[model samples]
Target: MYVAVKGGEKAIANAHALLAQRGRGDAGSERIGYAQVRDQMGVLVARVMAEGSLYDPDLAAKALLQSQGDVLEAVTLMRSYRTTLPRFGVTEALDTAGLASERRVSATFKDIPGGQQLGATFDYTHRLLADELTTPELPTDPLTPPSGDDAMPRVTDLLGVDALIEPDRPDDWTDPDPADLTREPTVFPMSRAERLQALSRGDEGFLLALGYSTQRGYGNNHPFAGEVRVGEVEVEFEAPELGMAIPIGRIELTECQMVNQFVGSADQAPQFTRGYGLVFGRSERKAMSMSLVDRALRAEEFSERRVSPAQDEEFVIAHADNVQAAGFVEHLKLPHYVDFQGELVLIRQLHREFEERVAAARAEGDARAERRTKKEDSHA
Candidate 1:
């Protein structure tokens, strides 16, 4: 009886129906349209797209609506939908240098080319809520148009001019095609490219915490935000038959380059090192955290001590997918009747054995005491 288990089909059907009804919200409330979710909740949509590994904002908005704002569930929905879509050839590498920059800033230098443009940030805002919920007009600042040399050079380029940092692509460094993680079984000893791909799809909160751990002395990572630029970058896919790369629209990107101090090693001179992070949409905070974690994970490459979880590649990469982690944890809500009964039976048997042993020991002790008293009385 304990070994047998049954599932309630009617109960589950009704439960699912109730869940669907709740997902629709109260009948009187205004319906959340796709445009509202896609635009107003743009940040959340960006997050869902990033973690879902699907760059479709409309679908992400729909998933959010279907899941009723449950981020993990929405991500799962996106991931599942991605499996149904036909994948085309890989796109050419994105040229972030040519980004139509929206917000650009540098912690290393205040004075930079193209200037520090604070485009749509809550950085200087007071941490207080307004009395009424109202949409305010977006203010645009009048600025001088860019000339021939108004293009912003990378911060790393400045360092490279003086040889203050190691070259990102060294003389002998070869650019091999990165493995397609979606199709291939993830092998141990993942290349930097593979690690980067995983990090891009990793959970924001998980990466943020690990990045914070590095700052708290968990790893040999004290980094400076050398540069963080958010902008739009065009994606182009090469057509084999046409023999040309066709533009397939543009996507917003957040790129962060982290600069960290490096002491001289046996084979190298003392110079600053860099960690690069790029993510979909204008997610500067996530990009920054990812950069920190990226540098921390490069402890082996930099010949630094690996003493933290952030620096552990396997540990970080394996647990980064929130959907997988949630599925493992959330399944506990499902009925484990048979399994629970097995545990229950074993525990009860153990308790009975323990009580019987205790009783036997007590009886033996009492018998010994009575025997000793009788022997004493006989002797007396």
Candidate 2:
């Protein structure tokens, strides 16, 4: 009782053609160039790089152009392209302490070693759209660094002097490289490295919502922004031929450290717990949200009961990819006539059977009442 529909191939091809035409805009208008996207849409390219987990700005820009400014699609395109590239040796871990910082702030202390520098942020800007942006004008002044040493001591390190912050635990420096979630399947009870990797490429909006929920008392951690820094760090890789680590390139990064209040447990002393976030480019919002979610997921380690969505690692990480979520939801538009017809047939059969049963019950009741009335008449 099912019929299959066919002949979607030609339609699909035509749809794709139309999509390409629309993506390019009208023939009368000037086409958007790759250079324009790379240079002008710097923030969008940065987002693609961060979410795609790739550092190639040129390729990210190309993906942006191809996707018609759809950030998630651009990220998906970049991630797909990354799989085609040759595998290279792992890079040495970066030292944030040595970063040439463009922006650094500490909410814990008003007077840190390096005074707070609010650089290129829209936090204080008015929300209204500006008319000048329709025809943009470049800034007249050249960029200049604020007066501060490049080596700004970490706020956490300052607190460590008083033993107020948790001390760093020594670990094996030669331990095997952590599992790459991109290549390997994600297993339950993931390591901190794996968890952080997932958050680095997670959907910004999803993380933002979870972070907001935590702040709204769903899983309040009383988080304080220990430090937020944006800067460039050199990427070094070990060269077997050179017998030393060589600087490959420099990448911009945004890092956030959240200090949360923790009460003493039976085995542990009362101290502030830390949640860390580091992402590609100047992604302050994503970094802050990642830190909040990171802290929420550590509820088990802290021996706290998981009572909110933010604390559910499986749920959060599984659905954090915008690409995956969109694909699954949008797949509903595909042809499902045959499957739906089968369900329709089953539903009709069930309705018929129900009606038959009801009719039989009614007939039986009527016969019994008629028989009782005849018996009463004979008795009269």
- Which numbered prediction scores highest in lDDT against the true structure? 1
Clashes (backbone N, CA, C under 3 Å), per candidate, total 0, 0
TM-score of each: 0.92, 0.88
Model 1 pairs whose backbones collide: none
- The superposed Cα distance between candidate 1 and the true structure at residue 173, in angstroms, equals 2.2
- Give candidate 2's error at residue 309 in angstroms: 1.4
7-58 in candidate 2: lDDT tens per residue?
4566667768998998988899998888888887776788899889899888
Query: lDDT value for candidate 1?
Result: 0.87
Q: What is the TM-score (0 to 1) of candidate 2?
A: 0.88
Top TM-score hit? 1
The lDDT for every candidate, in the order shown, is 0.87, 0.85
- Residue-level lDDT of model 1, residues 1-380, one tens digit each, is 11223455666677689999988789999989977899988889989998898998999999999999999999999999998999777899998877777888899998987778787787988979989868777658655324333378888889999999878877998878767777788887888889888999899999999999989999988799999988888999999999999999899989999998889689889999888888888788889989999889989877888889999999999999898899989888767877999999999999999999999999999999999999999999
Q: State, as a TM-score between 0 and 1, how close model 1 is to the true structure.
A: 0.92
